[model samples]
Target: MPWPSPPVVATGFPGAVAPVRVGRQGIYDRRRTLVAYELLFRNHGGASADLAEGAEQDHATSQVISATFGDFGVGQIAGDKPLFINLTRGFFTGELPIPFPPHQVVLELLENVEVDEEVMAGLRRLKDQGYRIAVDDFIGEPGRLPALGLADYVKIDVAAAGDAFDEVLALAREHSRDALVVVERIEDDALFARCLAAGADLFQGYGLQRPVTLEAVSLTPSQLVCLQLVRALTGTDVPIREIEDLVASDPALSLRVLKTVVSAATGTKNEITSLRQAIVMLGPQQLCSWVVLMLLGGVTGVDTESLTMVLARAAACARLAPAVADLAYTVGLLSGVASVLGMPEADLVDTTGVAGTVREALVQRHGPAGAALRAVLAYEEDEPCAITGTGHAVYEVSRAYLAALSDAMLTVGAVAGDS
Candidate 1:
């Protein structure tokens, strides 16, 4: 088990095993982002501990794949839209957990292992069966062509071999016309922008995002005051005229507010200038909405990481339970509050107004939604077997549905599921 980092990236840990963070991440695109991620394994049942005699079995080692990864595989990212995930050769050859969908989180076959006929045949089956295939860490291995042909995407580890980036890109182009060629592991702003220019459809790694600091941005004290005034309007009790007065006090705030008023997509546009007129036009409700939205959009970098995690998790849950997407959304949000606020889940669920079914499922594991919650948690843990009781658990369509629920959050969006 290791400590977790980043919003979306999760790694398996010995403790709660919430969402196992995977190292090495990339989104194919930011706006029209494709779902792509990497898993850093602590154990695949091949490690020494697995071989040790009478050693306490770490049967839970694959929990990350079951509880988390599976959620992303079944269109949890963007709702039936495609995403990509790395699949080790071992999983193909051996009994490794593959909790995600063949459609979403398209398998990026690892390069470290041999691809026998059986493997190729299986991949062909998956492709024919509607799975999207991808080749990982590909560096022009002629032997990989068969697999690549079945794959929908080819992930080139540009950072691993930067000197030969051009050649790899060339090879990638030849291999992928309908298939996407992703430039992964871009680690700096320069590299990020460069990859985009080089015909890269997707980008991964931490270089594009960094901690946002308000101090660094050039802003006058008056501007800061105006921004604070904008932010303060979010409180429900704030009056319209005061908000208008605050904006009027600073022309910059008024301008920002006016532009936002027209540009708002969710709410009707209101056009007005000056303090009192603006208040009358927008009214209290729309003003608050605009202020809150502006504040949120302004938050960047680490500031938004926790929000991303909550939203992504909820999105996965939504795919699992469209009927319960709202409940799952609330539960998912509450589940992470402890992580964000340095508290415990136990301390907050009662106060959160979480429905009885979700509360029981989260806490006692004894309610109707318990199994569903467990399935989602198990998929995150990489334990596809959890859906079925261990050895009793056989890969089935039901398990696939559970996996789909979580994964759909990433591919689709949050959906309310049944109890």
Candidate 2:
């Protein structure tokens, strides 16, 4: 037997500077333990915040790959975990070599990658080199599968699979007994459980972050009340006393507000006795935002885990664009409402009287607030973001999200305890 060859990597551009950082999202096994991280290219500073399309996308992706091997190195980026990297058709059959050790890399062949004799030969060579292979967004009968024999993983889009999931799973298993069956786009707990039941080996998507709206969803009375109050407050310049009265009348809402304020204010301030005082102390805008946060979670029937995730995402958006942070916060908090409530996002925004810019961002990613919100959402999904600004990088984005997670947990915990 001959010795296996190493990954083929391209030479670096002498003067080219890679982005300040890269973003990664984990692929979790059935045990909910991380097995791999899918790397995404992100720009430094706020640049255009869309996934680079056409030639730009190719260049951006190549830049990421080159930088991964060039400046950061695989070990520093992925630690001991395997890196699942996407390969464009060009990279797949080209002479460029992957710089990382074969055992630690998983070449993800894009669903649309051109597959032919050369591609097949490349796959064989990669397998021989000890690199795992995965077919991205795979959809095919077992007998007709591309890369079926060489692939170590087959990723299926649950939304696309629909009723064919069981059949697909069965076929994939029949053909590749040892390969992992990974399910993507799982939208909620129910579907996640269903995928697990169907013998899925790994999972992805925001399904764990919020409920997936398979059908129409109705709002409960408490949720309705929360929306109405938010609309009234945000739509008009309501007096602080009136706002305080509205919250004071709702014992559950009042209790949560008081608890959050009291808990947060612990050594810093004197005890508060009244809802009005608490409202003033929390700042009217921020306190109302928290109430809206509570309402959104209530409407969605979100578990603690889901609520925590939503709040952290919202806070991270605020951190990313401080000038429009308030609007960004609102956008982050309500971003998942559509999936949970089974309502059009536009309808929810209209009903809630969200600012036009916020609504625009939620719907179309139109403004600075929209850009910031998109960046946060993109990071969560481990996808590309068209960041447009100066000095924004993966390091700052990661720090903001982590900080928000801590703050959100404490806030949500207080509300949960009081409620």
Candidate 3:
């Protein structure tokens, strides 16, 4: 499999050395877990925060942002920046891979999904637990109203979504005036002005990170091991002892764990031996979540990483689902299972004999249930994700998804308890 380039931003370039490319995502000024001045940079088609040359100030700033958020070449965030990460359906279900701190991150929900009631309640629970939530495409919907009412922030596109937008913002304000409403896709000055007039509290789009060419970087074997362990830890049946053994399998991973355990940064300064101790110390739930989130930064073995992604996406859905439908719960994570394993999605489909709706979702993105299953991919790309429509409609659908996920995990945990 080919290696994908790591996300990067030019640290510095002579006003002449290929200009720095940046794409921006607006964070509500009132956001507690997001950076207001967040910038996503592109160098060629890749992300390069390493300023081999250019202005000293630009170089320094790039290092701070990239190092703080781009895994710092270790697949981990710098801990200083507001935790901002794209939230996808897969992530909600525990089907995809993640590589950061969820407690500190803000999940920017997209606007293309088919959410249900279960997903909404689950989201409410997550929100109660301290996770910040934001809805993209702040459109209105009947079924989605329940979930939308619960969101902390709402985002809209002034040019496309409009006074229809104001109506939605007004609605959000009516419920939670403190809820930050963001206007995305601001093309020019006039639109920006309109957004201000409409009470938009945040902003995003090409206005932030420019598209650049890609530059692929090579990784050492240790990096590979760390990623494998992350994948292993995330498996539905993975055990704490298994995770410990995998980490202990390689000296590099051992060192990474030691550093993480002792890093005054993570706020945990505990000591452990072997991998099991680390798992026990960290707690399987927290340990697994951290390992998966860390891998979100970027890892080697494109295929494995992609599989990890599919899994993470599915997992996110699981986290959201009220009832694991059509094996959509497991199939969501496993549908892409073959791709990452280097086998054919077709063969996996044949062997797993997954339900037709699920297979349709994976192959064509068509089906009512698929909306719940496939939304994971849409979430990963951060594209418009819909779960009914804007307002509380989509929110309700998201809640339905989360409910199913909670049920599945609880059932699985209980079964595991008996074992």
Question: lDDT per model, in order?
Answer: 0.46, 0.59, 0.45
Task: Give the higher-TM-score candidate: 1 or 2.
Answer: 2
**Per-residue lDDT over 257-329 for candidate 2, one digit per residue giving the tens place of the 0 to 100 score:** 5444533332444544334566677665556555454442323222445445656766777788887765566
Per-residue CA lDDT of candidate 1, range 185-299, in tens?
A: 7688788677777777777665653211111010011323335565665566776656654553332233334333322212433332123543455555555443333332221
**Per-residue C-alpha lDDT of model 3 across residues 185-270, encoded as one tens digit per residue:** 76765666666777767665444433333222211113355556657865788766567545543322332343333321245544
Kindly indicate the candidate among 1 and 3 with the higher TM-score: 3
- The superposed Cα distance between candidate 2 and the true structure at residue 372, in angstroms, equals 46
Please tell me which model should have the higher lDDT, number 2 or number 3: 2
Deviating ranges (above 4 Å) for candidate 1: 1-24, 30-36, 42-63, 67-83, 209-419
Error of 3 at 413 (Å): 34
True-vs-predicted CA distance for residue 232, candidate 3, Å? 8.3
Order the candidates by lDDT, highest first.
Answer: 2, 1, 3
Winner by TM-score: 3
Query: Backbone clashes in each candidate structure, one number apiece?
Result: 60, 15, 99
**Which TM-score value belongs to model 1?**
0.41
